[model samples]
Target chain A: MDPVREVEGRAYPFGLKNVDTDIIIPAHWLKTISREGLGEGAFEALRKDENNVFDRPEFAGAPIIVAGDNFGCGSSREHAAWALLDMGVKAVIAPSFSDIFSGNAFKNGILTVALPQEAIDRLMEVAETDPISIDLENQTVTTPFQDRFTFEIDPFRKHCLMEGLDEVGLTLERDSAIAGYEARQTGEMPWYAKGTALSA
Target chain B: MASKPRTLYEKIWDAHLVERREDGTCLIYIDRHLVHEVTSPQAFEALRLSGRKVRRPELTLAVPDHNLPTTARLDEKGHRIPIADPQSAQQLAALESNAPEFGIRYFGATDIHQGIVHVVGPELGFSLPGATIVCGDSHTSCHGGIGALAFGIGTSEVEHVLASQTLLLTQSKTMEVRVEGELSPGVTPKDLILHIIGTIGTAGGTGHVIEYRGKVFEEMSIEGRLTVCNMSIEGGARAGLVAPDEKTFAYLKGREYAPKGEDWDRAVAYWKTLKTDEGASFDKSVVIDAATVEPTVTWGTSPEDTVSIGGEVPAPESFADPSKQKAAQASLNYMGLQPGQKMSDIEVQNVFIGSCTNSRIEDLRAAAEVLKGRSKAPGVKWAIVVPGSGLVKKQAEEEGLDKIFIEAGLEWREPGCSACLGMNPDKVPPEERCASTSNRNFVGRQGPGARTHLVSPAMAAAAAVTGKLTDVRELR
Candidate 1:
């Protein structure tokens, strides 16, 4: 599923640190409990402000968001990821991301690119002027001014994103290995081997 | 080759090993999977798209907390705070849909049994000793209060645990936090832990699993042990542990999920040996005197920046390190308190006496005793008392603690993460300072620009009446 070419997108910049899931999408929005319509709640509190980052006219319809370090530091709410995706954030450029938040982003087709502080600062500047292009196949982000920065992603996530595969898809690819393991473990750990492996 | 006698960690770990990696991390089989509504949706989807079934459905349990509203059917039409935050509702929907599909137990809103996952896990005996339990919530470590090797996992790990009841993890080093002597009368486990964090400076136990030992822990109630372990993360420890004893067995003896019949006898016998051996050495050791700990409150953003009830707020220059001094000054300005003001005299706008931190029945009772006949200040907007668990909530109601909160003009609500950072419905307004019993007072965690002063339940209750950080010792 690894692509020979790169995937690219526009840069939507959000320059906030310690941006928690609660802020990404408030909890009260969780009533219907469906993933749909979550994008509306993305940055609900911030959107409430007249001058919030998401409401900036200059950054309208931007795809890539360049953010500060420690972005998404609190809560394990995946809706934060869903809402961001629905809002058209294809990739997030940041100094760092909260571990759980980053994983959720990657699984949901949003690329969480970790760049050095200098790289983020430069990207933020470039994003304000024009859109940035990220070639996932090439593992590089490029601007018209010839500024280029390469980012690394886990090979597994890279493969999935290239193929639009989720974690379930990735695991499905390993069916043969899983089946083989189950067969082997049946005798190794009988407690897990009862009936069909499905029950175990 | 001779090996050391196995501790509970060794026994459970050895029993669950599926494979050992060259790097020394074991592919450890997880025995129990407890999840909250907030973190399970993505994992559930991963399971669905992969066409995988739960490795053990019966072993997994789910509950809606974190983001469930304290006031359902609340009006949002021109309300100050949005009545419904759509994202949390969606997350809840995902759980409501998937739990039944996967055959996992789902406890939702006001369900006589719905509460904080960790609180309910033990009360129902779902968190047994010598078990490997994984939850996406960081406070999952609260289960470690009963000698379980429970740890918080990421969303990806949550997916892993769902598809397969196992994780590949490196074993952690053990750190023993010994709290000795009897606690001072007004001093509780909440103060004891805040004192530990204040002394240890937040990152003291990073990368190590802390086992709280000594007389203070032994004498502490189960609810108290939970409060202590709940904040272990504040000190940066992965989790906290307490070896199971008669107290642990007594708490679990007749719980809903506890082993019945002869299995009960065997489970207790096995649990007794879960403790560390006399000669067993730990990677690190720290000891504190319980009698010396007083009512504590955080003076800065981090949990470590705490002082005693009667102590004056620290001046920036009091910190010798230049960077710390600067940060202290910055925090003081952000909190809007004078550097030299008496710690016990800072005014607060609200009083929050619950959360996973100190929302047990005993915690409510402790707070209610102080608020029994007293009413809070009129201008204080909210006095939130969200219980930690349905069982605890029921117990408190039976004891009329709910009436006490009501009589004091406080709002008595059902269990949920109410004002805790896990969600944001019942939050403090920006720039408003409040006394809270929850762990962590990171900038604006209570709400956007809301200031939180972390204190014990007793102190938080006292502040409810006086509208300031009054000493709980004075109330007595």
Candidate 2:
């Protein structure tokens, strides 16, 4: 994962609510073991229209998406996040997001900015012709028109995004704590670990 | 004062906590991990690239469900049939090899035990009360019905769990969805959940874990509870749970992965303690009259766009908010529905009676009861019943449910999430409306240009017989 401090670029002002993962990448494109090349199929259903924002010339390769409430509401497919990143999307601004999608976005170094609908409406307005900026350290989304909106994020997630930390490695670093817990579980709840040995 | 009463979720969270940081991020251990084909290839590939072996292989179980074809997998000569789609074949092959290489137990496509990961977990007793289960699929919440703290994780988190057997997390606010009174006859668990999602919009339970409470849930069978919990994701909740009780213990006893002898007695003793204590508080609460729930079905693209079988399609202007109105209009357009049309009059060309949401033996029996002496209407071009797993299929056959479906002109197919999503060959044709028992009525969920009306198994059977979205109660 690359460290994400600031993202600034033209935004696709797609304010559609309840945008699910099936629409983000669709089940047909889930066949590949590889994560690359998914941008081609990203929003394939929505891209059918020539006037679709994702396919329009002005928003091509846009780094941000200004969307409506409940963005990424269904499915736990990280491919939705992977597809966004593959299409050069660095951030998504919505009134709200599904919990799983938000977590997936953070893991893949994509900034998910949640603001009030009024702010999202304003951002959608400014995003039509100008680029928007998201500053993770400041927790703010700003447009050139002096419109600024502050957002809330988990302190831990914010730290990881700024540093590009590998979560697995960090968890592994606390090996002693994990081992200690396991040692206690063996005596307290033996059945929990008994199945593993039988399988082995 | 007595110790602060805790919610079922809190008890599970405390039991699984391994470490906590100053920022409230807790490293919680995962007891069971379920894996499927669609979302796991990349995670396994990442493990290979990083040279990290699975930390606890026995805790993980892998199976192929999303992309496996539901057709026969063997020929007259008993050789394996090759998957037609090359990409899907490669993905399935990857899991077949990856699981063993990483020392994880896997049930192959042809294995009798193989099924939808969510369905496989509970039936095999891998999902237990007070356990923390995670999978790379949204419906992992299905296991929560058995009182486990199970929720879905993305592939990156999938890799994290595979490598560490733990997840870094913050606690979610708890909600109680209490449905008092007995559900009226003909209103199945599917209808109850659909009605709940209708009451609470798709994003109603966002950022919270819902604990289902009240007489309605307490009386529901484990299978019914699983059916209700399976769609918690569709309602925008991280997970949904029902407290473990005698029913839960009865469902798990003597199962393959369940504890034996003294362990079973001890496990039950602990599980009995997994309920919410009196005076326990919830961050939010919703109460619904179970008697008010009808034979519900989704009217449009979103699961929240639901109506009772006797209701009429709502006009976009009926929605109070501008955005919701626009969404309603768009949904009507996509569903090819008229604003004032009767829901029971909506015609369907196909019928699908299976998915992780409604493919258990009890579900099969429900559909069979509706179709016992009837045949699908001639106008219904295609109908199929795909069991959740091979074991479910065999069980249904033993109970003569397969004969009932086949006699009703419905295809009794092998199980593996068939027709639930468009990932496999079982798809509803373009422009066709389907009465489906699967979760999600999203655009193109069944196939491109396919319009799906979500319903219960009995309702799906009713639709097959009538060639329209008819109420199961009406058939009686």
Candidate 3:
């Protein structure tokens, strides 16, 4: 799922707001749960018009999607992120993401690159015709003309994404912390103690 | 030896807290993995690509409802047309194909049990009280109605849960949202939540877990409780929970996944302590008068942009915050509605009374009761009822609720998350207006250019009969 950690690539910007998951992979496409066949269905509605973004050859393989504020809202369907990923979108630069959508993106190793609307607007302008490069380690997005745009990401999310650690991997790292917490909770909060015959 | 404090949420949170990190994210374990067709494909593929099997296949339950078509493919507005595109067929096929391979118990299109995941999971009892459930669907929090610490997980999280049934997360602060007093006739849980959202505004519950307490919640039915908690996210709450009691146990008894005879008492014991303590504290509190909560509906895009049936859409200038002026104007324009218009005058082309948020047997019965023997209003193009679950559909039909709907000029359809953005078959056409029982009214939420007003089922029926939004209480 960790396709790439460092975002040193071109950003393709689709500046739509409140992009619900269904539009990402229309429910019409949800009849099957396979991944390979999804590319055909990704942005099917948008592709219906000959003049839409996906049909334009120049933006065909855009890596960065610049969405409007509150993008990816509604229904916690995670396929929305998968469709973007499968369509070759490595990062989504939006003012904000739905709480659920952001989590899904993180788990899938997709960077939910939240940037200030002003900063995103600038990238959107540059990305429309020119490729913009994002550097995760340095937290900057640089253009061919050497213009630099910096963004903020949750440091821990950055660390996990950089290290390609999924939740399991992250959890294993805290095995000791979990063990300690359990020991303390059992002794102090006996009534809260679980996993005995209670679940019988 | 000092011990840690335990609240019901904390106890559940702690048991599931697999690991704690220096940065405050907790890698927590998920006990039950409820899968829906909508978000499982990628995760299934990830499992395949990684050469992994489901860590606990038996603990996983799967169902496909969001994307199923209620009617064969049609171009009619508001009617659920089957998805005929090849790609859609492929997506559904993949889920059907992969489910058996993983040994996950799955309910499909023709399955008598197929329905919205939130509805099926709790009814099936897989999401038992005190258990931790995670699904790749947001309304996963609907399972919280049973007092489980259930929340929506994403596909990557789905893969994470599959490999180890755990998640890394930051915990939310606790907030007690208490609604007291008795609701008047014509009011329902849908209205109650609408009223709460309107009062608290959409962002009121941000960063918090709302625990519904007090007399109103106590008197609610399992279905009613589910409706309130279902839209907690719209209120910006991370999740919402209700403490389990006899009402909860009664709902679980004899369910497919609930404890059988020998396991019942022990199960109840574990469930009893899931309640908050007498002196326990919450980071915040919001109290409401249940008695005053009338049949409510949304006049604006956000759930918070709601008012009582008799109220008017607020003018942009009425908003104390100048920044809200643009949004008010945009909502007024997009909805094809005017500010200061009495909600009673808002015309509706369709009334859809089903979704994960509403569409329970009780919700259907309520709408049917209002629509009984009444013909749909002229110019009201469509009126349909899509029950949330197969079980609800079965019970409603047996009770003759379907006949009432039909007699009153409404089409009754099979169970699914119909018209709730889980699928497109039931969407309202762009530019048309619909009074929907679904949870959201975001732009294009129902369909492109579709203006949606969220309402209770009875209110929806009222709108269907009047061809415009009207006070349900007047008809009652």
Candidate 4:
């Protein structure tokens, strides 16, 4: 995965609240074995209306989604994040996010930026006619009209994102410590070992 | 000197902390990781591509539930089987192939232990007190009933745990919810939780881990506790936990994975200390009168859109928040309900009694008790019961719960998360309203354009009999 220092593009001006994973990508679309091409199914229900923003040609490759509060509120489906990424959504501006969904988005290199509702409202307006830019390095979101909003993020997450480090890569960095712990665990709890204790 | 107070969540959380990072986040080791067919395939594929193996395969268990078809035929060796849906077949096949490749244990559809990941973990003793558990499914919080620090994770987190056996995390603030008094007859744990969700709204528990206390939770049966903890996500909580007691120990004793002989005594000694100490504090607190909770049902698109069975549908204007008001109007339109319409007057074409939330043996017995010698209403088109696990199915059948449901015109089917997710053949037709025992009422959660009314198993059974969302207490 490439480092995501900044994302600059027109954002989908959708400000709908509690836009759940179901609305992001319906359960039926989750049936496919491959993760590729989910963009076609992204917002499948909303895109049915010809006038919907997802189908609007101007925002076709928008790299950001400016949504309302409690975005991604249902289901632990990573498909929601996959759909967003496939649709080229590099960052989501919302009042808040469901922790599980935010975690999923983070792992997939989609930045979830939480701002106050007023800030989200302002962004929603700016996104309607202007492009938006997000700088993860500075923790600030800006619009072509000079609307600037600074946000707070866990510094560790920001570091990982800028460094293009995933959990696996992070863990492998501490491989020696993990190996030591595993050896101790095996010795102390032999009953909990796989084949010896429970039939798998 | 006075000691600083700590919640049960903090105590457990602090115990599992491996390292505190410079950025206010910590690395916490995971005791157990559960995997399912739907969310894990992509994670496993990522691992394969990266050439990384599971760090601790023994600690992870895999099962197929969400996309499983419950009405499949038996094969030559007496294994219940179905794979007609090509996509479902491929997903399950991927899990089967991937589990062995990574040395993670896979329980296929044919295995008796194969069930909903949450249910199988507890019934088979994989979830234990003081353990930190996670899964790719949100309802993984269900194991917190055993006093474990359990919550859901995304597929990437699943891959992270598989590769490192730990999650890098930021902790959540703690909220305490105390339910006082005794529940009214015919009201179950499901009613209590739905009542709480309705009171708090869907996002009320955001950024917090909720601890359910008071006499009601203490007195609740193990299965009832599981039912309550399973829906914590619907309340927008990262997780919900109950301090384990004797009932918890009794439920685990002698189970397949539970400690044995001398280890049992030592384990119980430690589990007994897994509670919030006296004078401990929470960031927030709420109190619910158990008597106020009735046979609850959701009448809208979200779990928070719920009310007592006898109550009237709330008008959108009743909500103080404008966004909530708009959401309520949309929900009312989608649910095909009118403001001020009594919940009891709304009709339902189907009654589905199964999900990770309410598909256990006790849930089956509750519905069976209501359906005994009673036939479904003539207006009801489809009434079905899908068990959570094969063992639960076998237990229900042995106790004649299946016979009662079958006699009542409700189809008693095999074990899996069937109509709950609608990933398989079982589905509610478009525009048809259903009284469901599932946790979610999200639009199209059951099927496209299918309206869902979240109700308890007993109420769903009663609805099957009366063809509307009738209060079980009235029938009693």
How large a fraction of the reference contact set does each model reproduce?
0.13, 0.68, 0.38, 0.52
Docking class of 2: medium
Reference-based lDDT, residue B145, model 2: 89
- The CAPRI category of model 3 is acceptable
Per residue, candidate 2 scores C-alpha lDDT tens digits across B413-441 of 98899899999999999989999999999
Decreasing DockQ order of the candidates: 2, 4, 3, 1
TM-score versus the correct structure, for each prediction: 0.78, 0.99, 0.84, 0.97
Off by over 4 Å in 1: A1-200, B5-11, B72-88, B320-326, B422-424
TM-score of chain A of each: 0.83, 0.97, 0.82, 0.91
Tell me how far candidate 4 lies from the true structure as C-alpha RMSD in angstroms. Answer: 1.8
Off by over 4 Å in 2: A196-200
Better of 1 and 2 by DockQ: 2
Query: Candidate 2 at residue B368, lDDT?
Result: 95
Model 3 clashes, total count = 13
Please give the distance, in angstroms, between residue B148's alpha carbon in candidate 1 and its true position after superposition.
1.5
Off by over 4 Å in 4: A179-196, B1-3, B75-82
**lDDT of model 4 at residue B429?**
94
Each candidate's lDDT (Cα)? 0.75, 0.92, 0.77, 0.87
Cα lDDT tens digits, model 1, B1-476, are 96676544565666566666555655676666888876677678867876888877777888888877776433457332333666676677778889899988787774777888888788777777777777987777778887788777766678887886666565777788888788878888889899998887655766578889987778777878888888886776757887788888888777777666666776677677787766778888898887788888988876788999888889999887564677688678778878888987788888888887788888999999999999998767888899988888889989989999999988898788778763657888888888999887876678767788999888888999888888887877
